[model samples]
Target: MMNKTNKILIQWLSWPIHVRIALIVILLILFFGELISVIEPKEFPTAFDGIWWAIVTVSTVGFGDSTPKTHAGKLVGMVTILIGASFAASYFAILSAATFQKQQAYVDGEIPFKRKNHVVIIGWNEKAHEMIQSLRAVKPFKQIVLIDHSLKEAPLMENVHFIRGNPTNDFTLLKANVKEADAAIITADQHKNELDADMQSVLVLLALKGINPSLYCVIEILTEHQANNAKRAGADEIIKTYQLTSHFIMSSYLAKNGLSTIYSKLNPATGNSFQVLPVPENLVGKTFKEASIHLLDQESILLGIKREEEAKMNPPLSYEILAGDYLIVFSH
Candidate 1:
């Protein structure tokens, strides 16, 4: 008994086979007519007239205005017409299929973005949603594409495109437009074994980098050791999930009551209530007092300034803000 999947596969394969056959037949008849015409000059009135005679004969649209004189030429023209008719039929079928595919993709919302810049999120996990929310918060305008093995349901958010397949699969990534994506964030594949997560992440990063060397990628890892391995695997950033959660829990305990509120609010929840705004390099020479106007103008509070591998939270009002400072800002 043939499985349903096998039936569907056969149906899909048939279309491509038909198209290929049509292409081959079209080329064969076209070349055969050209060769026969070249060999029989006296039989054709002129080159253009001969080509016209060939087209009409091969197409089975004999108008009788131009006919092959020699018996051999007439016999060849008859055979060529059958071949050309088959070729024309095949060409029409292929053309119709190509048009149908475009229309179907549009109807199904599978159209590619014209801008060609997007962030691709590979694999699915609880953390994947969090990362998406974080990215949406930080970069609201950024285009995001999600790829997963089982996308049974549509994403909760609007404009987040989905391509259902294995992230490590080259075809899947290509469908997600990974080559043109500005960045790719790969979360740990929860359905697979933990040991395999790092390997899969490496494969995905290698695939993307192989396509576009400058493409940036961030991989989520379960351990610090895996983080190091991922970095070596060409990850621009390796987020250690365990360490981050540990820090959060510890900080939450220390804060306890209202202090915990500060920690919770400060942590990137959804793209909604909190965000970090990197201070512009142009403002680096000035102090907080100088750049405070811009922050105030934006109606966002500067929680602190992160500069040169250090964070000075609630820096003194007089603190000097240097270049490369990132402002931890909170928006109500």
Candidate 2:
């Protein structure tokens, strides 16, 4: 019996500190309540009354409705006040500390993400920041997880969960719950040179695909040559940053305000932006011109058709739409 009792006590002591403190607080109240009721039955008529008095006295909310008349009961009350108050204070203090520690861990990016189907963005840069902001503007409630090893703390943004670790590491990807994520974006590391950045991005893409082959990955490659490597690594879409930037710069040079015009059209706040949608069943077997006319009535402009892995912008008017093709449109 003694061994069993000792084992039980040891098991209870091994429990979490907050749980132990809470249990101790409740036991203190019950033990003192029963003792005072037995010592002064006239003052505390029942165990319930003694418990009510104990609660009131322990909380220091002394109501003069109940008082101990005998010296023994008064001494019990004093002991209750001393021991009960200490346990109560300790419980609250531990609770507050635990809350603060959890919050601090989150800010420090030490907490792992537990939610599923979130968009995970790898690397921290101006492009990543803008992408996050743009995503928030488009879908206010969408969950986003940002992974980067360079950051000391998570960025302050709504619906953005940050994981501080190398994107190439499987452990880091798991920390962001990448296996359950809907999609992932691998941004080229700005700190490295063009070739090195593209290599790093491809490595991260490979890691992501290794963990979740179904994860739709969009990777940015600084060099055009690395785009094929990114595609070979299971990237669904590869953004050639240098080529696009050069084209945009050239366009701006040839036509004043070209860059600003493009930015304005792409801005979510403008309510006129690009959207990729599955080809409607009705649109299948129709020509590009017919699809354009059909979409025009709905205030959307058909810009391109994404068939399988290729996106042909402004295809010939007589081009026929297929069943599995996706339509790229500029919507207002």
lDDT of each: 0.72, 0.91
Q: Worst ten-residue run, lDDT, model 2?
A: 257-266
After superposing candidate 1, which stretches have Cα over 4 Å from the reference?
A: 1-115, 130-143, 152-157, 193-195, 258-294, 309-319
User: Against the hidden true structure, what lDDT does model 2 obtain?
Assistant: 0.91
Considering summed lDDT, which 10 consecutive residues are worst modelled in model 1?
A: 263-272
Question: Each prediction's TM-score against the native?
Answer: 0.55, 0.92
Local accuracy of candidate 2 as per-residue lDDT tens digits, 1-332: 99999999899989999999998889989999889899999989899999998888888889979999989989999999999988898999999999999999998888999999899999999999998988898888889999998999889999999898899999999999988999999998989999999999999999999999999999999887898899888889888888888887888888876565666567775577889999999999999999999999999999999999799999999999999999999997
Q: Model 1, range 104-130, lDDT digits (tens) per residue?
A: 654343554444589888876777787
Best by TM-score: 2
Candidate 2 off by > 4 Å: 1-10, 257-259, 322-324
Count of backbone collisions in candidate 1: 3
Per-candidate alpha-carbon RMSD to the true structure: 10.8, 2.1
Clashing residue pairs, backbone N/CA/C < 3 A, model 2 = none
